[model samples]
Every structure is written in structure tokens, then in C-alpha cells.
Target: MDIAVTLEGLGQGFIYVVIGILFIWLVKKIDDWRTRDFDDDVHIDDGNIAVGLRRSGLYLGVAIALSGALGGSSKGFFLDLSHLLIDGFIITLFMFSSRFINDFIMLGNINNDQECVKSFVQPDGRKVVGNTAVGMVEAGMYVATGFILNGSISGSGGTFVQSIVSAILFFILGQLALLIVGFLYELITPFNVKNEIKSNNLAAGIGLGGILIALGIILMSSISGPFTGWANDLTSFGIYAVYGILMLLIFRIVIDKLLLPTTDIATEVKEDRNVAALIVVVSAINAVAIIIAFSM
Candidate 1:
């Protein structure tokens, strides 16, 4: 390998790093706008540390994931600046749009006031409380969205229009996966997920969030690679669906038997706000994600 070519690749990677930083800043602005009413005070307080950290993690994770995906398609480890900027813009658009979809699913229609925003407020006009559950759920959603977007564009050797269309298709597929996960959660749990999160049930929120991330990871493998046609895609989806279900079942059994033999996870999570149980579940989900990501 030529040293000059290697250096050029490194230089392009640095450019991506700079783009990631700028995108994170843009996300912060959007977050502020979304939660403006909650944090209306001019004086910034320290009450939202957890929320801030979660949001920061989300932005950075997405930026890195997307940049890495773009890097995979670059020529000889070097991306053209113009192409990098354009791809970055497209990714940023998809990221924000995905977040909007997540918000709508988790919190309902915010514009119609049929949401949970009011629950975060206090009579004194200060929303000082940081709901870690909601933050965790949102963070998981961001990771899921990033993975789906990344997988969609991972080896897409296509024109700009084709890439955009592929991204849109994968995004819709990702949303459908999320809906299925949500439905599964509802079937397994007795309590309502939105109500639990709105009431600050950290355990319930984390448990549901873990499932979302896990599904994203499982589907990521299926989404990557060349799109031969609709028939091939459908066949791939069927095979991956079986694999995902089996893997989830194994993880669930392992966590219950090995990780927490003395505890009933679902009951503990629903009734007691058991943070430890929730953490174990999230860890199990993420461990599977890591394994699958590496294998792919």
C-alpha cells in the first residue's frame, strides 16, 4: 500500500470528523427547540445532566455511524470533499426525519397536544426533573435509526436518486420493525408503555427501549448488501426474521436463567421500577447487537 494514499484516506476521515461535530451542534439546536418550553429559564441549570448526556451520546453515535458507513463506500480510503458534504447533508436529513418518526411513535402527536409534554412541567413553571427513562428510550431510538440508516447505505453503489430511494425504503422498513417490537412489548407486558414512560417508570422504558435497539441490530445485518430485486429482498427478510426471533429467544432465556435467576424481570420492571433488572435486559440486548454487528 502506498503511504501517500494512506495519508490521504486519513485526511478524508478527519474531514468526516469535522462534519460530525457540526452535525452534532445542529442536533443540539433542534433538541433545544423541541424542549424549549421545558427549559424556558434563561439561566441554565444543572438538573438536566442525564438528559444532556443522553442527547450528546445520541448525536455523536449517529454521526460516527453515518460517517463510518460513508467511509465504507469511498474510493481507495479517500472520499471527495463534495461527495462527503452531500452525503453528510443527506444523512443529516434522514437522521432528523427518523427522530421525528420516533417522537411521533413514542410521544404521540405533539402539535395536537395529545402527548406527554405536560407531564414534565411543574406548577412553578420549571421543568427541573430529568426523566432518565424517557432519555434512555430516546437514545436507544437514535441508535436504532442510525444503524438502520447506516445499513441502508452500506454498499449502495448507485446514483444520488437511487441512494435516496434506498434510504427511504430502509427507513420505512426500520419503522415497521419498531412497530413490531412495540407490539411485542405490548403483548408481553401488562402495562401501557407510553403511560409507563410518561409516569417516569424507568424500568419499563428501558426494557422497551432495549427491544427497539436489539431489533435494529438484528435487522441491520439483513438490510446490508446489494439489492438484487424485490423477490431477493423478501427472501432475505424471511430468513433474517427467523434468525432474529431465535436469537432473541435465546437471549431472553439466558438473561432470565443466568443473569437473574432470583428475579422475575417483567414483574420487577413493571411493578417496582427495578433499575437493575432493566440494566440487565439492556445489557443483554446490546451484547447481541455488538455480536451481530461484528459478525456482519
Candidate 2:
């Protein structure tokens, strides 16, 4: 390899890592400030499972979005750096917007952060902490949004304006897709998912949250890559989104049969609160999504 090319690649790689760390750090500060009333870091230090889970999702999600923003086709170091900063800011705003979306749209009845933030004491010197179930859902939403955001800005061979416009449109579609996924999930499942989650059913929350992330992985493939003509790209994304959703739905049933042949997933999740069983469901969903993403 040429010395200049090798050194330039090394420099780019180094800056990316540094920038990625800095973004994560900056977002954490912003997040902590945004919800100072809850103080996730403080509670996390105190072993608050809900805060821990919530924070975990946000961190991972931010990283995912950053990777997509900075790792795509490069126009040069300066251009890439400019895009990184711009996209990072946009992503930060979207991160907060995602919380609002999760609060109002995904689980309208539940104040998700409220559930994750507050704790209470019991009669016999016991503490009933914040709801891990709600935390899981919140976490899942962030993680899913991370993947969606990644796809939104990952396209290349286009102007910055084009990329921004594409991201905005694709992100809107992603939000809609997520909502549809939630609706379809509730529609097909035997028990009422929202009610189950409200009741602190960890299994139910895990199942829903895990599926959301899986769907995001599948969607990223459809939305990412070099941009072609507007009409062609839009059509491709629409077809892929529908196809991915349908396949996920089908896989839900398939996993139930093949992975958990003996266990009734609904009963386990709703009645027994079997988190282990739901974990199996999550793993299988993610596995299938990754397969579909790569196979395309």
C-alpha cells in the first residue's frame, strides 16, 4: 500500500474512534441533564435496574447512529468530519424526539420514563424499585431507533442536502414502521401486551422490545447504501420495508414452532412471566433479521 493512503486511512480510523467516544460522552451529559429529576447515573450507581437498562439502550443506540453517520462513503476527511458533526447534532435531537415518541405513541398509557425513574418503599423494610419492564421497553425503543437512524444517513453518492432529506423521510417511515410493528405484535399475540407490560410482566416487555430491535436490523438494510435516483430508491425502500415486516411476522410464528416447540410462548410470557423463554424469542428474531439483512 502507498504510505500516504495508509496513513490517511489510519488517521480517519483514529479520528472516528475518538469522535465516537466524544459523542457518546456528550450525549450522556445531555441525557443526564435532560432528565435531571430522575438522574439515571445516580440511580444506576445505586444499582437501579430500571435506570441501568434505560441508559444501556441510549448508549448503544447513540453508538449505532454514530457508526452509520461516519462510516459511509467518504468525500474526503474534511467533508466527512463536517458531516460527522452535523449528523451528530441531528442525531442528538432525534434521540430526545425518540423518547417523546416512545412515551406518547408507542405506549400511550404508560409514562415510560416515569416508570423507570421513580421507586417506592414497601411495608416490611423492602423497596419496590422502578419497573424494569418499562425500562426494557424504553431501552428497546432507543436501540431500535439507533438502527433506524443508522440507515437514515448511511446512503452515499448524494449531496449533503439529499442525505439530510433522505434521512428525514426514511426516519419518518421508520417511526411509522415501528408503530405498525407494535400494532401487529399486539394484534397477533394472545394476551394484551400493553396490559401485561403495565402489570410489570418482564417477559411481555422483553418480547416486544426484542422484536423492535430485530425489525430495526432488518430495516437498516433496506434503507442503507449508495443512493440511486429518487424514484427508484423510494420504491426500493417501500418494497423492502413491507417485505421485512411480513417476514418478521412470519418468523415470529416459525420461531414459536421450531425454537420453543413445547412451550406456548404467550402463556409463558403472560401467565408465567418467563423471561428466559422470551430471551429465546429475542435471539431467534435477531438471528433471522441478521440473516435477512445479509442475504439481500
Candidate 3:
């Protein structure tokens, strides 16, 4: 048995675990700072689902970013840690940009941050504080950004300039793709996605969020691997993106029909507000995305 190799693996695992804990702590601090207008600690301790969802998304996105930076090369443990710290921090910032983009650009009609924290009253006069729908959208953005940022940090070859440029370019392109896909997703759905989400429909939120994260997973490979010049990479990335979008959209309809049969996905999401139906959509979409990402 290669005891030295095993020992090294164990040591690396231990270090990574420590780093993960630190990153989680950092995520919490960021959350507290972001929600400074409101007492996040109080809301969270009061069992606010909205706060929980937001925090979970941040944690999940950061974890994904860490994994991406973790990929490629073994330039010793210290070097790896440095790479992760630098790339991971940058990616974290990039992922958080989703909030601005979602609020002002993507879903301009919705104020996700405000909605998440505000309190409301249900029709039956029962008081509802947290808007889990906004939380779901935020969660999806975080996770999707994580996957896209993962692609940005991954790959090999190229000088430092080329790498930076590539990362920046891909990040821009990735956001654009997401914006377009999000628009198309809205078009394809029978119901008004934005309106539903605005009304705090958890089902619609999960439905839309599911597709965004799935697209992010599919696109990760388009920007991954060693740089082989801008033209080649751009063309490849563009082609792969188109394919991913078309296939994923098709899968959304086909899979929902095949699995649910009698149930209309549109009704389940828009009218019935069936979170379970959307969960099925998310699971199936992710399974297909993983397959397509690998096959590509």
C-alpha cells in the first residue's frame, strides 16, 4: 500500500475540510452584511424560511465555486489554497452580482431583496412574513452563478492575461446566456412567470429556478478546459450553449409530460402551486444536464 500517497490524501482532505469551514463562516458574514438593513440574526433565529433559503443558496454557491477553483493541477497544498482563496473570492463576488442583475435586469419587476424580508398577510388573515418564492429565485441564482463561475475558474493553458480575459469574457457570456434563457423560459411557460413569482408563488419560483441552475450546469463545460485561442473557444462555447438551451427546453416539456402524464406541468406550477412537481422537474433536468455535460 502506498502509505505516503494515502497519508498525503488524508492530509489534503483535512486541510480542505478546514478551508470549507472557513468559507462557510465567510459566507455567513457576507450574509449578515448584505442584510444589514434588517436584523438577519433575529429573523433566522425566528425560523424564517426566506432567510434560511437565502443562506442555503449562498452556502451552496460558495461550495460550488470552491470545487471549481479546486479543479486542475496539483501545485502543492499551499499553492492550491492560494488559488482557491483568490479565485473563490472573486467568484463569490461575481455570483452575488445576480442580486443586482435579478432585481434590475433579469426580473426588473421584482425587488427580490425587499420582498424576501417584508412581512405580509395571507388572504385568510393569517400573517405571513417570509416570501419563500423570492428566496427560491435567489437560491437558484446563487447556485446557477456557482456553476457558471466554476467554468470561469477551471481549464488550463494560456498566459495570465489570456486566463483573466477568458474568465471575464466567459463570465459575461454566461450571464447573457442566462438572461436570454430566462426570457425564453418565461415565453415558453403557459403562465406569467414574473407575475407568479411576484405574487409569491413558490411553485413558479422553483420551476424557473430549476431551469436556470440546470442551464448553468450544462454550460459549465462550454467554458471549461484549456484555452485554445479566443475564436475556437467562443465558437465552441456558443455552439454548446445553443445546444444545451434547446435540449434542456425540450427536455422540460417532454420529461414533465412523460413523468406526470395526466398532470399539466403548467397548471401544477402556475395554478396549483405544486412545489413537488417543480422538484421533479429540477431532478430530471439536473440528471440530463450531468449526462450532457459529460457526453459533450
Sorting all predicted structures by TM-score, with the top scorer first, yields 2, 3, 1
Residues 271-295, candidate 2: write the lDDT tens digits: 6788899998889999999999988
Error of 1 at 8 (Å): 2.5
Candidate 3 lDDT at 199 equals 76
Instruction: List the candidate numbers ranked by lDDT, top first.
Output: 2, 3, 1
Per-residue lDDT of model 3, residues 222-280, tens digit only: 78898888899999999999999999999988898888898888888776878888898
Poorest stretch of ten by lDDT in candidate 1 = 109-118
Candidate achieving higher lDDT, 1 or 3? 3
Report the lDDT of model 3 for residue 91.
Answer: 69
Worst 10 residues of 3 by lDDT: 120-129
Given candidate 3, what's the lDDT at residue 29? 85
- TM-score (all chains, Cα) for each model: 0.81, 0.93, 0.93
Model 1 score (lDDT): 0.65
Model 1 segments beyond 4 Å from truth?
38-45, 76-79, 107-128, 292-296
Clashing pairs for predicted structure model 1, backbone only:
none
Q: Cα lDDT for residue 83, model 2?
A: 90
